[model samples]
Target: MDFMGFFTKKSSKDTAKERLQLILIHDRATVSPELLDNIKEEIMSVISKYVEIDKDELEITMTTSDEEEGNSPALVANIPIKKMLKRR
Candidate 1:
C-alpha cells in the first residue's frame, strides 16, 4: 500500500481554488475561450511560415503584467521553435 498517495491526494478545496483562479483570469481578460483558441491558431499559422515549430509544446494564455503604473493583463505565448525555414 502506498501511504504517500493518501497524503498527496488533491482535496476538494484545492480543486475549487484552481477553478476560481481560472475564472478570475478569464473574467479579467474579457476573452471567450473559443476566441482565444482562434487567436492561437492564427498566430501559429503566421509563425509557421517563418520557422518550424513544435506544435505539441505550444502554449498561449492571458496573464497579468506589471507596468510602470499598474497591473495590466497581457497575452503570453510560449512557442517552441524547431528550426528556421530558409526563404526561397
Candidate 2:
C-alpha cells in the first residue's frame, strides 16, 4: 500500500465542514444576510429604546430549509445583555 493512499478517502469532519459551508452560504443568500443584519440592528435599536444590550456581542443568523424539512426560512439573532451593577 502507498503512503499517499491513506489520505485518499475524505474524512467525515471535512465532509461536515463542506456541508456546513454550503448550507450557510445558501441560507444566508436565500434569506439575505444584509436584510437579516438590518433586521437585527432594528430590533436592537427598538430594544435599546427600552433597555440596554451589548451590540458587539450580538449574533444574527438566517436559515433556509427544503419543504421536506417542514420549516420556512427563518431569522435567528442572539443579543447578550450586560449585567447591572448591584448596590453594596
Candidate 3:
C-alpha cells in the first residue's frame, strides 16, 4: 500500500467537505465564520514560532466532551507538526 499518498495532499472534494464540516461546527457553537478564521490565524501565528506545521492539514473545531461533566463548549485544535524548533 502507498501510505505516503495518504498524508501528502487532500483532494478538492475532500477539502470542500472539511470546510463544510468546520462551518457546521462553527454554526453549532454560534460563532461567526470570520471570528473563527481570525482565531485560527492568530493561533497559527503564535504556534509557528515554536514549530513547523502543515497548514493545509490544520483543523480547529468546537466540541463538547464528557457529557457527565456538563456539556460545555471547547475549542479543539488539531495541528499537524512537521518539525519542532529548538528553543532560541
Candidate 4:
C-alpha cells in the first residue's frame, strides 16, 4: 500500500483552486503578479536560513479577514518544510 503516493499527488482540481485563488487575490489587491513572485522569493530567502524547506511547494497568498476594524487584508503563506536545520 503506497499511502504516501495518495498524499503526494496533486490533482487538477487542487491546481485549479490555487489558480483561482491567486487570480481573485490579484484582482482585489490590484497588484502585479511580479510583485507577488518577488514577495515569495524574499520570504523564502529569509525562512530558508532557519529550516530546510521544499521551495518548489511553497504557497504564498493574500486573503481578507473579518475583524473589529473591518475587513483586513492578510498575507498568508504555507511553507512546506522538509526538516528543521539547527542554527550554528
Winning model by TM-score: 1
How many times do residue backbones clash in model 2? 0
Model 4 residue 58 CA deviation in Å: 0.4
lDDT of 1 by residue, 1-88 (tens): 2878657868899879867866788798898999899999999999999999999999888777789998777888999999999996
- Cα error, residue 86 of model 1, in Å, equals 0.6
Order the candidate numbers by TM-score, best to worst.
1, 4, 3, 2
Model-by-model lDDT, in order?
0.87, 0.70, 0.83, 0.85
- In model 1, the Cα lDDT at residue 71 comes to 72
The prediction achieving the highest lDDT against the true structure is 1
lDDT of 3 at 9: 82
Give the per-residue lDDT of model 3 (tens digit) for 1-88: 2878767788899889877866676677798868878999999999999999999999887765557867656788999999999988
lDDT of 4 by residue, 19-52 (tens): 8976887788887879889999999999999999
> Model 1 off-target regions past 4 Å?
1-22
Model 3 bad stretches (over 4 Å)? 1-25, 67-69
How many Å off is the CA of 16 in candidate 1?
8.5
Between candidates 2 and 4, the one scoring higher on lDDT is 4
Clashing pairs in 4: none
- Of candidates 3 and 2, the better by lDDT: 3
Q: Lowest summed lDDT over 10 consecutive residues: which window, candidate 4?
A: 1-10
Q: What local lDDT does model 1 show for residue 46?
A: 96
TM-score per candidate, chains pooled: 0.72, 0.53, 0.65, 0.70
lDDT of 2 at 6: 58
